[model samples]
Target: MRKNSIKNIRINSEVQKELSNIIRTEVKDPRIHPMTSVVAVEVAPDLKSCKAYISVLGNEKAAEDTLEGLKNAVGYIRRALARSVNLRNTPEITFILDQSIEYGVHMTRLIDDVVGKEEVSDDGMNTEGDEGSC
Candidate 1:
């Protein structure tokens, strides 16, 4: 089969949805934060394993706890996915913390800071009114 075939894409999406729901409603671990979200999922072509990207809205400790909770509940999640999706072999779910959103925010803040400094310097250097006087 070709890489990332239609069938594989559909399977990945279904698994992502099912796993998100399972994590939200079924898992009762206290370590799992309520603000956790499934960012993305990538299923192998062979359908034997999957990587689930998760985003947690909190500090590093909270992210660690959330990941630990998901790791502990992997079995239950896989079972639920198997039942919800029609597949011969349920892919093994591996939860990975996604920090791209946080990184983007940081980058934006840095850009804004630079722009603010530039604007302040420009304001100080404005001699337009006295340009033709001298």
Candidate 2:
């Protein structure tokens, strides 16, 4: 058996890409997480399993509900994928809701807050820049 390289990843990745397109264009469910973006796809070397990373753009009850909706529609999506992809076996798809986007937003807000505070202090509010501070 030859070792699988990045090229070997193309087939499964194509499947994932196809699935993304279909979901965006075909899946006509209002609850299918409109803000959801397919972040990445990782297929096992055997091509029997894949974990899809997805990010939802907002933080609210709707976001949570959207993820739940995506979970429920996995089967239909997979079935649709099988129709278009010419493969011996269509890998099982698993959706993992990525919170990295949310984390990034939170981090950005925190940084902005810090910068805002610094600006206020620089206006002679807490300018105790003595030998004790950096």
Best-matching candidate per lDDT? 1
lDDT of all predictions, in order shown? 0.89, 0.77
Instruction: Give the range of the ten consecutive residues with the poorest summed lDDT in model 1.
Output: 124-133
TM-score of 2: 0.78
lDDT of 1 by residue, 58-121 (tens): 9999999999999998998888888888998888889999999889888999999999999988
Per-residue lDDT tens digits for candidate 2, residues 27-111, read: 7778777767887787776768878887878766767776777778888888888888877777798888888888998999999
lDDT of 1 at 99: 97
Give residue 11's lDDT in candidate 1 (0 to 100): 79
Which pairs in model 1 have colliding backbones? none
C-alpha lDDT of candidate 1 relative to the true structure: 0.89
| Positional deviation of residue 62's Cα in model 1 after best superposition, in angstroms | 0.4
The reply for model 2, stretches above 4 Å from the true place, is: 1-4, 125-134
lDDT of candidate 2? 0.77
